[model samples]
Target: MVHKFAFENPHLKAEAVSAVVMTDLAQQYKVMSTPHLVLNGTRAVKGRLSEETLLAAILVEAG
Candidate 1:
């Protein structure tokens, strides 16, 4: 879902990290499951979200 969104929005930068390998990084973001989104290194949303909802979060965080 996230990868698709990132692909469609070329301007948006997105990365996927392995929680198993990057344990510290995962802990920093408090990731508990797949598709965890940490926006702007602060705001975060866990679990799957609709594209519209994700976009709203990105816009709010960008502001």
Candidate 2:
């Protein structure tokens, strides 16, 4: 599912959307997160995943 949002704070919105996209993409690839980015359905990535980091994760998982 694709998700999009707009906000007065474009910076914050961009950041949030980036993180959501990463998590969603990760879910699509079945990265094996207990709660989808969470280590054990508890802790999750505290902030947005950088493009490089997201790409590497996707590539590693895809391979």
Candidate 3:
């Protein structure tokens, strides 16, 4: 759903950063907690989030 959302909105670029591969970057972002979502290099949401909640956040952020 996020991929399609991003695809439709070119301004939105969603990506995944591996904690294993991008350990340094993850630390820089302070990903000490689980279920983190970063938008435009800024911390957006953290902890368990539902699909609807996540989509709503993305939409709000995009606007």
Candidate 4:
């Protein structure tokens, strides 16, 4: 979804990392589940979220 969102939005950038390989990062963000999303380096949402919900999160974090 992050990839799709970034593809659709020109100004947005997104990246996917392997929790296994990026253990340090995963620990930094305290990732406890798959499909975890970190917005603006502070806000985060874990578990699957709809596109609209994800977009709203992005907007709120951007603000």
Candidate 5:
């Protein structure tokens, strides 16, 4: 999920928000240790999965 400190504290300066934004974006796009699947905006799953896992991910994302 994109967890920006500015979301909680709107007064945060652009520099601080940028720091968090860049970090989150990097993690989402990074090659190493990346999650196998992202469910919803927060949930993550790694490694091989079954139909149940797929269903859960779809449901979470749909919500």
Candidate 6:
């Protein structure tokens, strides 16, 4: 099963989307596979990532 989660902080925020239902969005963002994480619409890292790796990716785009 798929699930979506969300959270926010003074400095950062995040939400989850199910690509299966949001096909158009998934395509628009070039999310061709599962476990894809897009940060700030400026960059995306495909596949599952470790906490550190995800943070790094987000930082790159948050800049």
Give the number of the best model, judged by lDDT: 4
Ranking by lDDT: 4, 1, 3, 6, 5, 2
TM-score, candidate number 2: 0.29
Best by the TM-score measure = 4
Shift of residue 12 alpha carbon in model 6, Å: 1.5
Give me the overall lDDT of model 5. Answer: 0.47
What is the C-alpha lDDT profile of model 6 across 1-63, one tens digit per residue?
Answer: 112122433566566789999999988998878788777775777876777777666667767
Superior by TM-score: candidate 1 or candidate 4? 4
State which candidate, 3 or 5, has the greater TM-score: 3
Please report the TM-score between candidate 3 and the true structure.
Answer: 0.72
List, residue by residue over 1-63, the lDDT tens digit for candidate 1.
667767988877888889999999999988888878898799988877888998888888878
Identify the runs in model 2 with alpha carbons over 4 angstroms from their true place: 1-47
Error of 3 at 27 (Å): 0.7
| 15: Cα error in model 6, Å | 1.3
Candidate 3: residue 44 lDDT (0-100): 62
Q: Which residue pairs show collisions in model 1?
A: none
Q: All models: lDDT?
A: 0.84, 0.39, 0.76, 0.88, 0.47, 0.68
Preferred candidate (lDDT higher): 1 or 5: 1
lDDT of 6 at 9: 39
For each candidate, what TM-score against the reference? 0.79, 0.29, 0.72, 0.89, 0.37, 0.73
Tens-place lDDT digits, model 5, residues 1-63: 222423555543212123244677546644244334444436656666676665566556556
Write one digit per residue (lDDT tens) for candidate 2, span 1-63. 001222432422222223355777556545553323332233443335665664454345435
What lDDT does candidate 4 reach at residue 38? 88
Error of 4 at 33 (Å): 1.0
